[model samples]
Target: MTTTVRWHSIPELVRDAAERFGDAEAVVDGDTRLTFAELADQVRRTAGAFASAGVGPGDRVALWAPNSAEWMVAAFGLLTAGGVLVPVNTRFRDEEAHDIVVRSGAKALLVQNGFLDREFTGPPGVPVIDLKSDGRHGFLGSGDPLERKVGEDDLADIIFTSGTTGRPKGVMTTHGQTLRLYEEWCDLAQLRAGDRYLIVNPFFHIFGYKAGLVASLIRGATVLPLAVFDVDRVLELVEKERVTVLPGPPTLYHSLLEAGGGRDLSSLRVAVTGSADIPVELVRRITTELPFRHLMTGYGLTEAGTVTASRPGDPYEAVATTVGRPCEGFELRVADDGEVLVRGYGVMRGYLDDPAATAAAIDPDGWLHTGDLGELDAEGRLRIVGRKKDMFIVGGFNAYPAEIEGFLMRHPAVAQAAVIGVPDARLGQVGKAFVVPRAEVSEAELIAWAKERMAGFKVPCHVEFRTELPLNATGKVMKDRLS
Candidate 1:
């Protein structure tokens, strides 16, 4: 059956959850806790205050803050007022932050005092509203409830995708599309009511915002937000809150294995991880050593929330190997050039204010060119090969960097690795490895290790060691910098 939803907009979706799970713990952030019923009430009030402040339907409001309970209230508050939310990366430099706020034409901004301990001084080109101020709460909403119903196509949020070469593009998503995709994601991932979720992913990212908070609301799970990702803090929260579901990047799980010794990790029942360079060895250790009952991985991008996910009962090898079949209403097919293309509700409507780029991304036929290269098997599972741009030709053979990076990670000394194609005189092009070592390991040894495991074409001729690979806030290695 195709994906379907009863709620038309985000406010309605939240209202349904609040009514069904009234009085249940909806959110927990350190000392601040709110039940579903109370949370719903606050949302209406916040919306009323926004309305009082002149925010109306279709207005764009910027929210620049780290993960906190207030962030949740502010986000839903904007939606409740029929305003579109524009989330800013908490780690963005002042210049980057200014560009997004100005480019999106944000009417007002809800900003924190400081992010990562650095205060944002000077003009931000918009009316900046302090998050900790009474301004958000002092003004009272009309006593009348404002749960205005909206259509499925109503603009919910405009999330900017960070591009390396140029300015970020705002990807537009509607309320109905997001709700439907997560409904499939939650159902396939077995997210249930009463499950304690420890969300370490940043809220600005779709994984944390939709998959973390919105999914919890839909499934009636308790959300425990982590402002910062500290290994010790994650362990402490997991133990204290009895977190049952934790989904994060591979680095999160890697740290857990390294530092989680002797901790009460038995409460961890579900673990979800995904990336192009996921190693089978990591998946093996997670299943064998970790106490998680279900280990799954998924594949998605900023344009699409979660297009595919591994099933709960999938074989451990398959779970580690592929990013499972497409979610309902989503169709995945590889292009002749080996690029992955998908068409579904989860795909963003368009790139805001950039029709030429949108036309390039989503063809007239409606297939969204994903730029990712992958292969789908007869059983419908998809094995992500690598980025189409990252594939290198070695001695006339096409060698995907992800395949080689995964092989290099199997080495005991290698903790993280990224491979980029560098120009070569003899082979026309060759692979170079930028590696983050687990310990003091020589590049010579790592190159020798890769030679033994992978084919000659896939082996990196050059290896460079980094103390820590340059990563964006969302944990993806900045391959452009390496190149």
Candidate 2:
């Protein structure tokens, strides 16, 4: 398997790809298109630009932007120059972005200032390079690439977690880990050469950067980066570009499935989705309704990259019920308390610059204590029950929102559902379901529906109907805002 081939560092991989897939279509964004060789040239020039701007090896640089062809170039260039990448979420406000830039000790900032109608001025005193400006390519150097020795083990990026809890902590990873893991991910997802991949996931996130762009690079797939998810735009792109590989959260597929009926999506053969809970019905619809030959779901986090995934030929039930067997050499086990533990090469080095928190998360035995509660079937497949912190007690009975939410989704009226524990006088805490209904449905009707389907303690005591639920950039429901 080519998965065994090691490039040592991302720069090496960039150079190797240029040689191996030189004339193949690499990246396409609207009017802009580049071959693999051209993409490599841009990466080298960008690296030289960074070197000229006083970014040295090991220096941290903040990348704040949406998904674009330029975003991929800038990221590859940053890695080529041996600068550690710090990708800020595009949804972050000025204050939120400023906090990450300052905390990560980013020496420079590459940003698209006018994106989403917000001006990202970047932090004071830091050099800000506007990636969207006409002068952006002027930063590219005319000379040969900068001579920098970036080792595989060197820190490649510091990706911050979604700050649903108190504050986001930086998850540090290396180029070696990134390259190795995603190779396996591509093999499992059936991503291959000549495939056009529509990357709608944000590049700042691991899935987009590693599983989207990096995997495309490895397999010689064409990259079509979509800045935002619009169902019509996505369908248009899939038909026009003949996009073959599309992986995203469940919401992206739901939107596509609803509107993609008359479109020419026969070119789309590979589809992978997983970030939040997925309904079995949706999985069934995707298989029966869509033209995809390969469809799967997997589980992972920023702390652990591509730990487990469903391989091609796996049943739809495995894709829906379990995250599949472990990939990328990860060893998985459930603790006595039900928390899932992962030990692998893909685990993050540690929380960047926070030893106390690192020590608390990873045990002395080299096992990462994933705070998610899960169970293993006899076949060794993992079914994520819920997050340990997200679980709530109801009248001394443990109730998982994911489990209840799954039950609620079985109802025909519920388009989307998110359950949160709300304060209750008698039960200490009870499930409060926030639902986005497909048809006319009352809160009392949903509560009654839940009552008949689940245990009395598991049933939601209250239900709130809404047109839509609050979603993060990745289409994950923001449970933090539910109350």
Candidate 3:
């Protein structure tokens, strides 16, 4: 039986949350905590300031700050003022940032003065408002509300995906799309008003924005923000705030395991990880070492919101091996070429006016051709093998690099591994492996380890040992740059 889903705009969701949980602690960072009422007030004030600055509906306002309360306020403020928010990756270089701003045509930007020794210069011709100045808060202060009108179909944010090949394109998300995403996530994760969430992922990415910010706000949960990922500090926050929910990438889990060092993690009731595959070994380690029994791994793209997620009550294997079923209001299918196709409200509204890209990505029937390659099991769970563009043909055989990398990660000595296709005269294109070892392990050792488990062609033609692999802002290995 099918059921009709009710949709609300982003501002309406925020209004509902504030009205329902007005006095509840909505956000916490360091020593600062803002109640739901106060959070709404800040959003309105920031919106007023933006309106005064002449930002209105449909104008793109970019935010290039780390995980801070101001970032959240700026995002919501832009939405409240009917402005479109464009989130820039904090790890982007000046050139990358400049390219995004110019391509997106952002009228203004909001950024921190500096983060992690990196100072930001505002994009050319675009006014930049700093969030912090001389240790005093900047922007988001109390002000009068701005009279604005927005609908569910209005644009909310333009999140740029990590461009593995070339320049990043902005993925437009509508207010309705974001609201449906938050509600779907809340229902799938069984979120409750009593939950306290700790967010380590950057707010720029959809994973953190929807899962970390919108999910918590809509559910009347508290959000504890961290500007950076400090393994020790994260553990301390979990203990101090009694943080109930934890969300981040797989690297965070690995770091937490190393930093945990027998620290008490009983307060952590749920841990959600995404942005890359969660190694089964890491899943096992978390359950064995950490006090949290509910560990989950999910899948999402900037364009598709979060389509697939594993639930806490599912089997450990499901959470470890598969990306779970598609979230509610979404349909998933495997194309003839093995690409994952999605159709849902959560799918983005074309690539922000790039007709060529929009036509290439979404079909006429509204099916978004997710570049990731995967297959559905008999139980309807989706197992992501690798990116379609990353797949290479070896001697007329298909080789998925992610599968090979996953095999390499199984070795106890390997810290991280990236598999890429290097041009080979014999096979046209063959797989090559680059590894970062936990200890001193030679290429010969890794080659032998992989050969034993995988077919000869699937084995790395050559293994290169490196101190580290080149990772994008979100920490995913940049396979395209390796070769």
TM-scores, all models, native as reference: 0.96, 0.97, 0.94
Task: Summing lDDT over every window of 10 consecutive residues in candidate 3, give the lowest-scoring window.
Answer: 134-143
Which pairs clash (backbone N, Cα, C closer than 3 Å) in model 1? none
Query: On TM-score, who's better, 1 or 3?
Result: 1
lDDT of 2 by residue, 3-74 (tens): 565788888888888999999999999998999999898888888888888888999999999998888888
lDDT of 3 by residue, 208-308 (tens): 78888999987888998888877889989988899888877777777787677767777787777754455677777777777775766678898888888
Off by over 4 Å in 2: 1-3, 134-136, 140-144
RMSD of each: 1.9, 1.6, 2.1
List the candidate numbers ranked by TM-score, top first: 2, 1, 3
What C-alpha lDDT, on a 0 to 100 scale, does residue 168 get in candidate 1? 90
Off by over 4 Å in 1: 121-125, 134-145
Instruction: For candidate 2, list the clashing residue pairs, or say none.
Output: none
C-alpha lDDT of candidate 1 relative to the true structure: 0.85
Q: In terms of TM-score, how similar is model 1 to the real structure?
A: 0.96
lDDT-based ranking: 2, 1, 3
TM-score leader: 2
lDDT of each: 0.85, 0.87, 0.81
Deviation of model 2 at 147, angstroms: 5.0
